[model samples]
Target chain A: MGIQEQYRSEAAALLSSGEVKLVIGFGEGSTADRRRPLFARTPEEAQKFVLDAACIANLSTYLVTEGLLSDGKKVAVFLKPDGIRSVNILISEAQLKPDQVVILGYAIDKAEITALEGRNISDFSLGEEIRSHTPPPHILQEAERIEEMNPAERFEFWKAHFSKCIKCYACRQVCPMCYCRRCIVDVNQPQWVSTSSHTLGNFEWNIVRAFHLAGRCAACGACDRACPVNIPLRLVNYRMGKEVIDAFDYCAGENSSQKPVLASFKQDDPETFIL
Target chain B: MSEPFEPKIVAFVCTYCTYAGADLAGTSRLKYAPNVRIVRLPCTGRISPMFILKALQKGADTVLVSGCHPGDCHFTAGNYHARRRWTVFRALLAFTGIPEERIRFSWVSAAEGAKFAEMINEITEQTRKLGPFTQYQELQKVIETQSTY
Candidate 1:
């Protein structure tokens, strides 16, 4: 059977057997080429399940949405490797219980989608095998290009990019890890971050956005894809994530039991810069 | 001639170590540059990177984060955690083109009054040499001058 037929059958069985109350997958969007998130409760609804290159919404974000998890019903989500890593992070952080998530894993590149034989977050080790793959060449080149520039030129580069921010916050809204009840930008008591989209405020928002996800970001490129202004937010996140893994031998969501990189530290962490 | 440039500096220090060290420097008559204004917190771990950005946003040419030495945190391991955090935060700041020198991290124990004074003198002199942080200050000035519509 083709991959879409296989996905449809698996979703149907899970839903009809009452094993999963909801199967989150991709269905036809308003346009012929676009796909939207499909939440299926009945076996017939599960027939609409689609698997293709364009189904890249990282549906795990819905697993933590406002009213989804409160009911304690089991949820099965169609996932790519990036979505699987997000499940791992969410489970490790105690935000989502492992028993509550059933993952239908798959792999996708620019033009193809191939399903994997994993039904849960643990099935994909996400270990050295996954980490061995280097970052995309374009992101690497842009980061290195920025690194090679003089500090002033780099400053100007970022300033021009950040000045275009309209503070729509679609990036934050789409991020699975950005599950805070009240973000720092919303708190006005002393106002930890400015809410406006001015230059200084934009700088603070973008910096904090990247910093908050330094170690925890799943590197799913969801935020970058969601950015309205086309900011290279993933490159900054990739740089910080690389620093954590290189400096501390840590990779977020690689292992379910590992403590978060920033929350815990060793006695002998490198600190050459500190006086 | 116009007055020489004096860069404003903000020092976020732990009450247990660096703050006490600064107080000891004063009591011991140790001389240091008077450019820095100190904001005392409970421990180094309590000093969020946001504070550094806030200092710069409010016109401080440089920001200093001094805390207990490793294994000497008042809360036990706060400095260690802080050291790791600063390492990552400093790297992020540098990646964003915030000159690394503008954010200084150090460890100054209560008995290290001399070291505290000397470090302050060095940071103040370096910042003064770097001149005012015009890029960030320019952003702040624009936000202040603009009408809130």
Candidate 2:
């Protein structure tokens, strides 16, 4: 049987046997082409769960949300490889507990799911391997194109793109890892990012937002998928991710036991830039 | 033709070491630049990256965070953690095109009063040469104009 078929059956069995209170996965949206997150409470509902390229939302975002993970109920999340890393980061930050989650690793397309089964899916050993997996040709070309631009051109290119943003924050809303109870953008006393939606506000909002997710973002591309305006927000995140990896030899969401790169320190860290 | 540009320096000093060291500099009459305005915290670990950004946004020409030397932190490992955080934070600042000289971090224990004085004088001199922080003002105007939306 196919991996999707196997996942559906497994989900069905888990739900039927009372192993989980709910199974969260993807299902057909209100329209035929759209896919949306599904909350499966029964065995029959579990059969509706689908794993496809269109299943783009990072399901981990629901872990910390109120009324999503109840006191005694177990949450079974269908995660892609990157999605699993997000879960690891959340668990390490003490935002989610291991016992509270039942992760079902859904293999991406023809990729082998058995090689990854029951092992800690949050481990980042696969980061380099995943990067090697051929991205859609267009994405690779776009990333290369951005990398070729100088910083000023890169800044202007982003400024122009962000100028179109309406500040809907759908990008923030749909990200599984952006589970902060009080987002920095919402603080008004000092007004970190302007509350309005203008060019400068949009630029600051996007820059700071991307920076906060720098070391922790697992490159799930959920923010890019969620942006209503289709801003290439993940490009900024991807650049920062590469920088973190190159600068500190650290990768986020690889190990729950490892301290976050930004939260810990080394005595001989590079300080050539300091005055 | 113009008033001398006295750069505003906000120094975040840890209570057990740098803060005490600054106090010692004062008591010992060890002269240093008068541009620095100190905000004392219990430990350097308590200083958040947001605090540093806020200081820059609010008109500090330069921001300095001084703490206990590694292994000498009153809280055992507070300065160690701060050292790691500052390393990453400074990288992000550089990525954003902010001059790295504007943000400084150092380890100065209570016995290093002379060293602390020298650090301050050095920072003040460097910042005076760099002049006031006009980048923040430009960004602020950008924010103000963009806020209309």
Candidate 3:
């Protein structure tokens, strides 16, 4: 049987056996190639579950939606390796319960969706190999290209991109890691970040967004895909991710047991820049 | 005639150490550049990178973050944590193309009056040579004209 057929059958069995209250996966969009998230609660509803390259939305983000866990019911989510990393981050950050999520992992390369052989986040990996593997060359190339520029050119490049920001915050909405209840930008006591979408505010907002995800981005490309302006957010995020790996020997979502790179530091962490 | 550029500096200092250090500098009759405006916080741990960015956004040409030396934090380990944070933040600022000299991080204990004065003088000289931060100033000018209230 094809992988799609297999996924449908497995989702059906999970729903029929009451193993999970919900099976979150992709269903048809308005067109044949389009897909949207489907939450299947019944065995028949599981038939709508789709698996393909076009089903690229990181389904794990939905797992943390505000009301989904209110009933304390179990959920099964279709996840790629990057999505799995987000689940690991959520679990480690005490934002989600492990037992409550049954991950159905998969990976798509060259248009083939192959199911990953794992049911749990730790089943994902024991070290940085899985976390650092397979960063898309396109994103890495752009990040490197930016790094090659002179500081003034780099600033101008980012400023030009930021000036186009309309502040729709679609990037924030789609990121699985941007799960703050009260984002610093929203706090108004002293207004840390201005709310306007003008050049200054936009620069501050985008920089803060990237900084907040420094060591924690899953490199899932969701933010890049979600952006309506095509801001190349993944490149900025990839730059920060590379810095974290190079400096701290850390990768986000490697395992539930690993301390977050920013939260914990070694006494010997590089300090050559400090005076 | 337009006066020579004297860079405005904002120093976020911990009350226990760098603030006292500055006070000691004053008591010792040690004269330093008078361009810096100090905002005293309880510890270096209390200084957020946002405070640094905010100072720059408001037209300050340079920012200084000074506190107790490592293991000398009044609150114990506060400066250590601050050290790690500043390291990462400093890298972030540099990667974003902000000149490294614009953001200064140092340790000045309560007794280091002369050291504090010297550091200020050095920062003032360097920033004055670099002139005003026109990039953020231009952005701020645009923001003022737009006034999205």
Which ten contiguous residues of candidate 3 chain B have the minimum total lDDT? Answer: B140-149
Cα DockQ of the candidate 3 complex: 0.50
Listed models, DockQ each: 0.62, 0.26, 0.50
Q: What is each predicted model's overall lDDT from 0 to 1?
A: 0.88, 0.76, 0.85
Residue pairs in steric clash, candidate 2? A61-A176, A124-A254, A265-B84
Considering lDDT, which of the candidate structures 1 and 2 is the better prediction for this target? Answer: 1
Q: Which segments of candidate 3 are over 4 A away from where they belong?
A: B141-149
Pick the lDDT winner: 1
Better model by lDDT: candidate 1 vs candidate 3: 1
- Over A1-275, each residue of candidate 3 has an lDDT whose tens digit, in order, gives 97888889999998999989999999999898999989999999999888999988988888778888878888999998789888988888878888888888888887988988867676777365664475688876777787788888888888777777778899999988887878889999999888878888888888788888888888888988998878888887877777788788888888876777777777677767656
Residue B9 displacement (Å), model 2? 1.5
Where model 2 places Cα greater than 4 Å from the true spot, the runs are A30-33, A109-116, A119-167, A188-194, A197-211, A229-232, A239-248, A263-275, B1-4, B143-149
Q: All candidates' TM-scores?
A: 0.96, 0.83, 0.95
Q: Which candidate leads the pack in TM-score?
A: 1
- Per residue, candidate 2 scores C-alpha lDDT tens digits across A50-126 of 77655666788877787676576788887777778888788777787777788887555553344147623443355
Among all windows of 10 consecutive residues in model 2 chain A, the one with the lowest summed lDDT is A111-120
Candidate 1 per-residue lDDT over residues A1-275, each given as its tens digit: 88899989999999999999999999999987789999999999999888898898888888888778778878999998888888888888888988888888888878888988878777788877546756789999999999998888888888877877888999899899999988988888889778878878989999998989988888889889889888899889998988898888888878677788888999989999999
